[model samples]
Target: MARLESTLMAFRAKNGFDRGIAAPQIGVQNRFVAIHLVGKHASPQEDALPQAESELFQHELNHLVGILAVNLVSKDLLSADELLNRFPSHVI
Candidate 1:
């Protein structure tokens, strides 16, 4: 766990944009992930729940197989309102 945290920190320091990392990314067979949300925004209180936590974990889990969130988006970009209107809450 300590190594994973340090690896993630080092990666963010070097690349300047990574916020999370899956253990498999560094050859760790353990099922785990390290995430740093220090400078990021939290979900609004109006949300039914803090969706970002679940969403981010799910996003990172995909990295176990080398997949990414962008690979799951089936269409072009859409605004938040558009997404809410087009898909069910679970899909967003």
Candidate 2:
């Protein structure tokens, strides 16, 4: 949780805004999510994320369930070999 919080904080600091983060985003193969709400974003009885915190949670949930973001797309997707070939002598 702490790591997620720190990562989320750093992301928000760099990007100006962030809704949440998942453990997998930091290479943790566990199910954990961290949501941040501050000042006006801390709405009464709810979080006031314009993109919706629930949606962010759902995105993270997909990661916990072993669903990659790339899998969500069905058009012009690259195979492992093809994707790896585009790497500049380093692998993702």
**Whole-model Cα lDDT of every candidate shown, in order:** 0.78, 0.77
Q: Deviation in angstroms for 48 in model 1?
A: 7.9
Point to the candidate with the largest TM-score: 2
- List the lowest-lDDT window of 10 residues for candidate 2: 46-55
Look at candidate 2 and give me any clashing residue pairs: none
How well does each candidate superpose onto the true structure, as a TM-score? 0.57, 0.57
lDDT tens digits by residue: candidate 1, 1-92: 88889998898888887778898888988788887765555557654425676677778889877787778877788888877888867562
